[model samples]
Target: MTNDLRARRLALLKEHFASEVAQEFDRTIATFADSPRYEIMPTGQVHDGEDQVIAYHRAQRTAFPDQRHENVRFHVADDDSIIAEFDLLGTNKGEFAGGAPTGKAFRVPTIAVFFFDGERLVNERVYLDSASMLRQIGRMDLLG
Candidate 1:
C-alpha cells in the first residue's frame, strides 16, 4: 500500500518535528541516502543536508521560541511526494532578520512539498507568503 507507507512517513515527520526529536530527525532524514536539499521559495534560499536544517530551526527558535505550526491540509502524490499546508502562529519577541522584536503576534499560512525516496524525505520546497507576514509584524507599510 503506497498510500499507507506515505501516511506513515508523514506521521513520522510530523511527530519528529512537533516533538523536537533530534534523533528521529536524523534517522528519518537519513533515509534520503544522499545529500538532501531544501528550496525555500519565499527567499529563494537553498539549504542542503541535516546540519543546515538543524541550523535553520535553531535560528527560527531563537527568534520565535513560542512558534507553533499547525497542519491544515495534506496531499499525497502518486510518486510519494507530499504537499502539506500549515498555519504558523507565533509572537516575534526576538530579532528576526531586521524585524527588531515587534513583540506582535502573527498567523501565517505556508505550503511545503516533500519528495521522498522510499521512506526518507529527499527534497523539499517550501512556499511562504512573506509579504503578508511582514505586514502582520508591522514592518511593511504597504498594507495600511
Candidate 2:
C-alpha cells in the first residue's frame, strides 16, 4: 500500500503532467507549493518562486511553442523525490533565445527529478543535452 505521502506525491506528479499536456499551465502551477523552483542543469538556469517559474515557462514556450513531453517511466527515489524519464519533443517554430525560428523539430530524451517537501512539490531539476537538441533542430553550428 502506498503511504499517504507517496500517494500525494504521485497524484501531484500525475496532475502536473496532465495539466501540461492539456495546455492548462495555470492549473499545473497550482500543483506547486507556495514557492516553486525549477532547475535546468545544462544551462545552469534556476527558476525560484512562482513568478520566476512562470517566466521560465514563457521563455520555454517562446523557444518551442509546441513543446510536449512523453513520460517513458517513473521511479520513487527515496521519500522526497521522484525521477521521471521522458522524451521532450518539440518544433522550433518560435524564436529561441537569440536564434530565429528554424521550423525544425527535436525529440530528445530527458530525466526530471521532482522533489517534494512532504506532498507539495518544491523543485524540479531536469537533465538534458542542449547540443544534441540544437543539432536535432537544424543547428549544426551549435554542435561545433
Candidate 3:
C-alpha cells in the first residue's frame, strides 16, 4: 500500500518477466512463494505447484523458443495484485498443441494479472486472444 511496497512489488514483477523471457525457469520459480500457480484464461488451463508450473513453461517455450515481451506496461491494481500489459511475440519453431510448427511469427497483446502475498507472487492469470495468435501463425485450423 505504501510507496516502498509498490516499488518492491514492481521490481519483483520485472524480475519474474525477465527470467521468463530468458528461459530461466529456476529463477522465475524462485520469485514465487511456497506455491506457484498460472492460469491461461483463454484456454481455461491452470497449472499449479512448482512441477506443473515448470512443465507449463516448458511446453510454451518449446513451441515458441524465441518468445519475448515488448512494450510492457504495469498497473498497480491493489495491495495484492498488479496487472501487466504487453505484446507477446514469438515464432512457431516447434510443435504446438500436437501440431507441427508453421514456421510463422505472431505478436499478440496480452494481459497478466499477478497476485501476490506481500512481496512474493502467488498466481498469474493471463488473458490473450488465442484466435488472433493462431490466425497469425497460420494455425487457425486448430480452432476446429
Candidate 4:
C-alpha cells in the first residue's frame, strides 16, 4: 500500500513538473491544484495555491525558459512524506529574487521534503544553498 501511494505521488509530481514546467505546457495553473503549498525558505516566499504557483512559474519560465529540474533521488518516509534531491539548471535571462539579470548558465543542487495529506501534497519544505547559486550566476562576491 505504501509502495502504491509512493508510486502515485511520484507519478503526480513527475506529470505535473515535467509537463507543466519542463515542457512549458502553459497549463501550469491548473496543474498546481494537485500540488502542495511551496514555501521558499530563507526568503520566506510563499506560493499558497495552484494559481499562485502557476503565476510564479510563469514568471520563472519567462525568465529562464531553458530551466530544468532533474530529480536525482527520492525516499518515502514511514509517515508517507517524501524527500527528494534534485538539480536545477538554467540560464538567467531575467531578474530573479531581486538579483539582476546574470546572462549566465547555472546548475544548483536542491533538496525538498514533501508532506502529504492522503494523496495530495500538503506542504513542501525545500533546502538549498542559494548563495552557491548566486555565486554560480556571478552575482555574489563571496566566492571571489
Candidate 5:
C-alpha cells in the first residue's frame, strides 16, 4: 500500500481506539467501512452488524466501566490488515458473565487483528488472555 493509505489506516485505528475508550459509540462505529463486525476469538462470540456490535460494546462497558487499553503497539501486517497489541485493563464494577461484581481489577494481554477494506475497518478479531483475566477478577470457576 502507498504510505498515504498506510497512514490513513493507522489514523483511523487510533481514532477507533480513542473513541471506544471515551465511550463515544457513534464515533467508534464511524470507523467501519460498512457494517460493524467483531469476533471475540476466545469466546467464539461474533458481534455482527450495527446493532449487535453496539450492544456488545454497551455490555462490556457496563461490566467494566473503567475499561481501557495500555501499552499499545501496532504492526502493519499487510496492505489490508493491522495487528494491534495491548493490555486490556478493567475493573469489575458491574455484573459480568452471569456473576456478581467482584470489585476486582484485571490486566490481560490482548491482540486484535484489524481487517480493512481499503482505509476503513471491516472487522476486528480479538484474542485475549481470558484465563488470566478471569482468575484476576475472581472468576476461576468460569475457566471450566
Candidate 6:
C-alpha cells in the first residue's frame, strides 16, 4: 500500500512537469495543493501562494516561452519527497528580469526538491546556478 501511494505521488509529480513543459499553466496550477509554494534558492525568491506562483510562471515563460526540462531524472527520498534533476533548456526570445532579450539559448543544470504532505505537493525548492544561466543568456555583464 505504501509503495502504491508512493508511485501515485511520483506519477503526479512527473505529470506536473509534463504539464509545465507543455506550457499548460492551468494544468500546472491544478497540480498544486491549495496553498503551494516554490522557493528558488539561487535567486532567494519564494512564490508563496497560487497567485504568486502564477505570476512567477508567467514571468519565466514570457521570457522563454519554449523553456523546458530535458534529461529529467527523479529520485524518491525517504520522506517521499521527489528530487528532480534535469537540464533546463530555453531561448531568451522575450524580456526577462526586465531586460531586453538577447535571443540566446541557455542550458542550466537544475535540481528541484519537491516536498509533499501525503499526496499533495506543498513546496518545491529549486537549486540552480544563476550565474551560469545569466552568462549563457548574454547577461553576464549584469553580474558586476
* Highest lDDT scorer: 5
Assess the local accuracy of residue 130 in candidate 1 as a C-alpha lDDT between 0 and 100: 79
Error of 5 at 9 (Å): 0.4
RMSD in angstroms, all models? 3.3, 1.8, 0.7, 3.1, 0.7, 1.2
> What is candidate 5's CA lDDT for residue 69?
98
lDDT of 1 by residue, 34-136 (tens): 7767798988888888788667766776667787777657777777687888897777788788557888878899988888777777787889887888878
User: What does the lDDT come to for candidate 1?
Assistant: 0.72
- Provide the lDDT at 134 for model 4: 74
Q: List, residue by residue over 56-132, the lDDT tens digit for candidate 4.
A: 67777766778888766777788857788889788889877666777988888988787777666677777877787
* lDDT tens per residue, model 3, 72-93: 9999976699999999999999
Model 4, runs deviating above 4 Å? 23-36, 98-100, 141-144
34-134 in candidate 5: lDDT tens per residue? 99999999999999998998899999999999999999999997568999999999999999989999999999999999999999999999999899999
For residues 1-144, write the lDDT of model 2, one tens digit per residue: 257778778889989987776667788788887787899999899999878888888777878878889865889876678999999989998878678989999999999999887788888999998888988898777655
| Candidate 2 weakest lDDT stretch, 10 residues | 1-10
Task: Give me the overall lDDT of model 3.
Answer: 0.95
Candidate 5 lDDT at 39 equals 99
lDDT (CA) per prediction: 0.72, 0.84, 0.95, 0.71, 0.95, 0.89
lDDT of 4 at 66: 82
Q: Between which residue pairs do clashes occur in model 2?
A: none
